[model samples]
Target: MKILIIDDEAKAQSLLKKLIADLSLKVDQLFTANNLLEGIDIIKKEAPKIVFLDIEMPEYSGLEILDHIDLEQYPFKIIFTTAYQQYATEAFKLSAVDYLLKPIDPDELEIAINKALKIIEQNRLSSQIKSLQNALNELKVKKIALEVPHGIIFAEPDEILYFEADGMYTNVILKDQRKRLICKPLKHFVEQLSQNKFFFKPHRSYLINLNYMTEFIKKDGDYILLDNTIHIPISRSRKDDFTALLRETFL
Candidate 1:
């Protein structure tokens, strides 16, 4: 696969290179650009199969390139490399395979790569482009899963209320008064799940299902409740972000 790195950060660029090298993945070639203009130039020349794009730069932003680029003209799959927590929806809008948060984890990188491969192999260029746009607009689908005694207890994605971390376990709360214990860590699933505007991370330990949210409460700290029944704590670090995301998705 041919890949392009579009970022202003030298460290980030090198890190991605190291990741590919470490994995010994088959990449025919990799082209790097310091800014969007150079990135676009390389895109035209290389016509890479995948683009690893960073959102913030002095010369240009990731979204701007997405807005300007022609889907048919450049048929590469997109994988968003961002430091911001807020661009999850934006990534999906570009039909991005997955969003890699900064200080990128190797596990997260692996998951993103898997998702990207599936999207490109199964979808047409137009669909890929439209999905990316959908991320900026509104997420099309809400996927909810439940876990029982064994493993991932199958439940409709739409039936979930919220997710809360109980020590190491993440609970998938359903509207029908049942809570499913997801075996995997919340962070692990979040990286793999498709982008959804309604599903907001109110706290590091909690991933809220917006479909069930009925009230937002702010006091000494920030926290949210679903249907006025399920209460989840919002850590101090994520309080401001939680509020902002709530406003963006609901208000």
Candidate 2:
């Protein structure tokens, strides 16, 4: 595997190189670029599989480089490195993308590298890169890129009825009564969509979209009825908060 590090600071570049070298990752070529222009040129010439990008640069920000690349033609996994904590949310908006805080932790770096390698090997890079670009550019309605057996599927938050835990994977129920078994855990959806007011987790195994909810039934152990007449149970612990949220949002 080939790896490229794009950061203006010499210290940052050296640290990353040393860390990778010390860990003995299966990197055939380790390239470095000080600026966005140099990084772009090197990417065109070398075609590295993974890029460790720094958000802040002298001439151009790391995000600006995405605008220049044709993701479909040259698909590469990007692991963002930044000093700012605020950018974490933005970085995570991109499906399968990860961010490492400055003075990078070795454990976190290893995890990110392994995840990138797995995603690349599965041939899911192009869709993930496209999803990342879309997430970064838009904000009104978020689109989630779900990895299925064949490939990727893009779905809007409002279109989802609920998410059910299926062991390691998640079962996504849509408003049109279609179900997709995604290769992600229900907790993953909870973490990613929890920020949106319309999504909530009433139980450990379920993440329900409040927008698709039709009725809140308290008689039979506090379960909520969805648009398609699907009854999702609310955990005893979460029932109070769920009812409170329903009251605050609806009545």
Candidate 3:
């Protein structure tokens, strides 16, 4: 794997470089840049698989490097390394992507490398549909908070089984078959979740989980069955769109 480090601190880079070598990491290539522009140049030139991005830099920051995103250009994994503690939560909210505080931790570097490796493996494995998958992955919603009968529970994107519109409320059904009532209305939830996962509103009252869908067949008049018997009637307005999505995912 090719790795790029973008930091102005020479000592920090040197220490990280030594750790990279000491760990005997599987880095096929390594590139270094002192600032965001230089980093962007290296990224475009080398096309490294992993980036050690710094949040703060002269002129431009790491996020500014992505000011005008060309989605096709970003196949790399980013493990943010920074002295700033303020940005950790923001990075995590972006995804489950890892962040390392300076001075860097050797174990954290190892873990980040492992995570990047797994992603690389997935990239190779899904090469056929990578373009589509990556686009969808970017659309994945951030952490969703739900209000349960007891207080509130956080819902990660992956934990969702499906969502159902219950009158004014939206129920988020988790993978464990547990249901949590979202504080927002169904329309609000739908707009917020309009990315990533293969969720579709086949019916006005239901947003079916494309991942959990065992089967989608006609059952009980005009109703569509999510599985063998979980029926959700298709709304006329959304029927065509839902059908196309299902076709794109399956066929």
Best by lDDT: 2
What is the per-residue lDDT of model 1 for residues 1-251, given as tens digits with 9 covering 90 to 100?
88898889999999998887777478889888888888888888889888998888885788788666897888888888988999889778877777889888988888777777777777667678888897754432343445556755555556767777777678777778876777767885566453666677767777777788777788755667788887877788877777787678667
Can you write out model 2's per-residue Cα lDDT over 29-66, one digit (the tens) per residue?
99999988899888899989999999888879887776
Model 3 ranges with Cα > 4 A deviation: 93-96, 129-251
lDDT of 3 by residue, 83-157 (tens): 889988877654525798998889988988888789778877889588778767665555766776678777777
Q: Give the Cα lDDT of each candidate.
A: 0.77, 0.87, 0.76
Question: TM-score for every candidate vs. truth?
Answer: 0.48, 0.48, 0.49
Model 3: pairs clashing at backbone N, Cα or C within 3 Å: none
What TM-score does candidate 3 reach? 0.49
User: Whose TM-score is greatest here?
Assistant: 3
